[model samples]
Target chain A: MLSIRNLTADVDGKAILNGLDLEVKPGEVHAIMGPNGSGKSTLAHVLAGRDGYSVSGGEVEFEGQSLLDLEPEERAARGIFLAFQYPVELPGVNNAHFLKEALNAQRRARGESELDSVAFLKLIKEKIAQVSMQPELIKRPVNAGFSGGEKKRNEILQMAVFEPKLAILDETDSGLDIDALRTVSDGVNAIRSPERAIVLVTHYQRLLDYIEPDVVHVLAGGRIVRTGDKALAKELESKGYGWLTGRDEAA
Target chain B: MTTGEQRATDLEKVLRRGQQQLAAGSAADNWLSAVRERGASDVMTMARPDRKQEAWRYTPTSFLDKAEYAPVVEGPFGAIQPADVEELMLGDQQGTCLVFVNGYYAPALSRLAPGQHMPQVAVLSGQLGDVPAQLKAHLDGIAEHHHVFAALNSALMSDGALLYVPRSASVQAPIEILHVSVGLDEPGICHPRHLIVLEEGAQAQVIERYCALGEAVYFTNALVEIILRPGSRLSHERLQEESALAQHLSDLHVRLDEGSRYKHVSATLGGAWSRTDLRLNFAGEGAQADLDGLMLARDKQLNDVHLDIQHTAPGCISRESFKGILDGRGKVVFDGRILVAQDAQQTDASLSNHNLMLSRSAEVDTKPQLEIYADDVKCSHGTTVGELDHNMLFYLRSRGIPSARARQMLCQGFAEEILDRIENPALHGRATRLLTERLMTYSE
Candidate 1:
């Protein structure tokens, strides 16, 4: 339900994403695998509508609407979620309070009834435990003292709460251990449904073992060079992307 | 002498009061008379502070024109009271609620509050008999010998809040004192003195609020002294929502005895020129003190606070933290020093002052000092001044919060330290609302 055409972006006057294009339909899982400098995180940040980046040339459409014309909050209201590679630490805003504010903002934008504090507290008790998160974590300032894994799990918990139509997971499994990886992958898989689409951005084929993707695209030199089914991931894991892309393994 | 001549000639209208009470006064009254005369003579001698003085290093007195100020002997607005402001004052004693028409106490317009533990207040002049002896003894004792304005306050002081707590007695609720100034006639002056004595094992909370009622050219010189006996606890809050054109100078001295505790918080929101000098003396073992202050200045305003915390006994602890947020060319200065004496070992002290300057023209200067004479003591201090972090702003915006709202939330977070100390949830909610209001006002 998302289409990216000729996405060319620049950060601090250096080109990062060059002529990147991709698409996914509802109920489909797309995995974009690339080398270190393959611009995986840039695509996620660009789609998330983060500032300080100049979108040189690109057309991003979500559900037949132009995404570039919308603000970040507007994008969130339209069911677009980006699980950040590194979560921010809001020192004074409580984690539960932050989530409640975001939820209410989206609900208000959509003319839906919003949940109050009592209802939100009841909502978190179950959702936090579903991801094995400690109940006290919600009471502390947002990500103030959270570990790397707890922060990622919190991102997933937010995804579950918002139930976004499209989720772009950016290196959500990079720093996780095998146990954390399984938990995160299971969390993502648990939310899989016919009406939702998943875009998994990663540097390895290890996470593909848990939540299999319908399509795997090989990205090199800031652009996608190859697209294939799930076996392509295993082939690349065994042979690497240098053979098919004909580029030096510089990054 | 020419300007002083004009000032004295002008105050002849106000200083003419108290000739009768002046005939029959206490020993402290005689001392106050001498102090006031010294203030009149030294109005020129009390030089505006420069950067050369150690205590005035971070604070420059370029804005204060000593020549423009004259000693005021009486309240200017004799019989006028503004309808815009409300005074919800309470005291622990029983007496007339001595009101002020301008800066002068109008004993006629004032009446006594209800019962015991309700404030007993009156003008120090006409009805001084009902007040306890301790009140009269120390009413003029809180002012430091060297403070020009404080000594001036003692001299021509119109009226003040005098309190005395017997041993082991605690005032249940907060005691609020409001000093309102009304009229635009001539540049006038007000000296409000307060003396709070907490006997052994007594506890109390006192809040002092000052607000200017009119466009009158005025100055407020105030002195408050708190004496906490052994095992006594006291909390004092000082708030200033004065008019933009007014000048304010305040000095507070607190002496805590063995095992006594004192907590003080000051919030300065408005004033063209506002300065506070505070000193906390821990003279007995196991005494503790915590001083938390927050100030928000905007629109070319100025706010300055200087504090000294001295540990004279062993096993004493003190924490001093003050923060400021400056916008629109406004300036702020916070200078705090903590002194640990030779015998004051096992002392734990920390002082920090942080500022957020929203504009390039807005300025904030902070100095945190520690002088430790004993070994094996824990002492630390730090000061930071900076603009907003763009990364944090961007992070908030990317999460669906608008850029303006993101800035507001981040600024509120910067101010959260002081807001967290508000004990009551309703009060906390009010502080949060004020922070957000400042954000919006800054935006406009």
Candidate 2:
């Protein structure tokens, strides 16, 4: 479903994703794990087409179209979704209104008729229940004054609503308690289908227990060092990344 | 001559014209005549507002040099139709609308609700022959006439709306004062002075709206004085939407007695050059006042708001929040000051001014000042001038919304923070609609 070849990106003239390559197919889940400053988040951002990150050398193909040249909205219209690590707080933008506008925008871009308010409310209510988010939260401003767990759940709600072809979860498990982790995992697991691909970017193996991955890749020096199965996650958790990168565990 | 000297000369010419108009419409009442004479003399002697003065530093006075304004004595009231006034009426008003075209009361377009409990509503021009003692006492007394524009308004005051609520009467419907400035053949100016008085234990809501009819060079110098007696409450909303070729200047003075409450919302959405000077004075203890303002300036328009809040009695509280959205090369100035007298113990006051610049060239000068002379008082002031958050923009765009729509949504959100403060649903909806339409035209 997604392919990246020789993705060499820079942020402010400093290399982040250096010669990185990854591939994922439909109906599969991939886990990209790395230490701090290993370009895990940068990979997700680059895929989402965020500004200020100059892609010096990259050939990211989604389905069959080149993704590098598309704007963020264009990418979104093509069913690419990035669940932010830290969700932004829109002070005065209502969550439900924003979600409806976003859904309609994507629908309009695909030449589909937009959903009316009644239809949107019904759809959003069902999705909110799937993610176990309070219905009133959507009535308030988007993520404003929301708790950390609530923010993550809100992002999952958005992902469920969008139903993107490819979903990139960047550090979605961080700052979540055991209960929130299970809820988020359940939400993600429910949306797993043969036509959708999910990529989980994390720093720990805890999330893998709830939502098992088809493959795990260890990112070191901005490149994939190892690709293994679910058991590799446990092994790395027991033995820190020091063994994989030949550096101190604390570092 | 330098620019200042030229401006001074232009102001003198305008004042001289205003004096002649006042004499032509001479009133038999000596009190009003004396007031007009004093105001005219004050304008003659007072130094014309120049950049050298602190108050007029950011506000450009070159517009005054554009023409020697002809006082609007006899307006073409017949030119305005009922439908024209109907289009501008607020949805929630209780048909107590007084329409003024070119500073003259349009009786055909005006309506007063038939109710025994309704407040006394009259036109200033109609009552000038037999000026009521109560009206004369609070007309020029409420607002300080030291301001040059206020003095100018008093000097050439032609017509306005007067609202009087008796003691313990809670007015059910909002009183709507719609001031319509119709473009004439020459550069015209109108001074409409509004006086609203609420007796003890009275409650009322008033909406003062200023709208223009044509795209002509006109000036609207308006003054609204509000007096709240003990245990009284008033909610006032001022909406200024003038023509592109028009200049608007207004002064709003409010006096709060003991245990009174005042809520004010001012929205300046359209004008070439607009300035509003608002003052709130706490005369008795346990009074509270809340002020919220929103200004949108684009396409070289200049919008300025100066707020002065004084706490003279103990146990008084005041809160002020003002926001501005500027695009193009537009400029906005926010100067808010709060003062707590020495005897005003336990005063709680806070002021905040925030500006969002949509263009690189748009400018904002925000100054929030607090002068606390009381030993035991809580006072704070803050100001912020910033551009739209890029992260917020990115987050919106990443959700399939276009970049331009995302920016518009964000700017609307920034304005919604203040528009939400309008408790009246109809007025709030109108303001939101106007702002949304204005923000859509903004260039990315």
For all candidates, state DockQ relative to the true structure: 0.48, 0.80
What lDDT tens digits, residue by residue, belong to model 2 across residues B281-318? Answer: 99999999999999999979999999989999999999
TM-score of chain B of each: 0.83, 0.94
Give the DockQ of candidate 1.
Answer: 0.48
Residue A230, model 1, lDDT: 96
In candidate 2 the C-alpha lDDT for residue A133 amounts to 95
CA-RMSD of model 1: 4.8
Model 1 chain B weakest 10-residue run by lDDT: B6-15
TM-score against native, each model: 0.85, 0.96
Give fnat of each prediction, in order.
Answer: 0.37, 0.74
Clashes in model 1: which pairs?
Answer: B91-B118, B91-B119, B92-B119, B93-B120, B97-B111
C-alpha RMSD values across all candidates: 4.8, 2.8
lDDT of 1 by residue, B336-437 (tens): 889999999999999999898888888887778899999979999999998888767655655566667777777777777676765434335545665577
Give the residue spans of candidate 2 off by over 4 A: B1-9, B19-31, B127-133
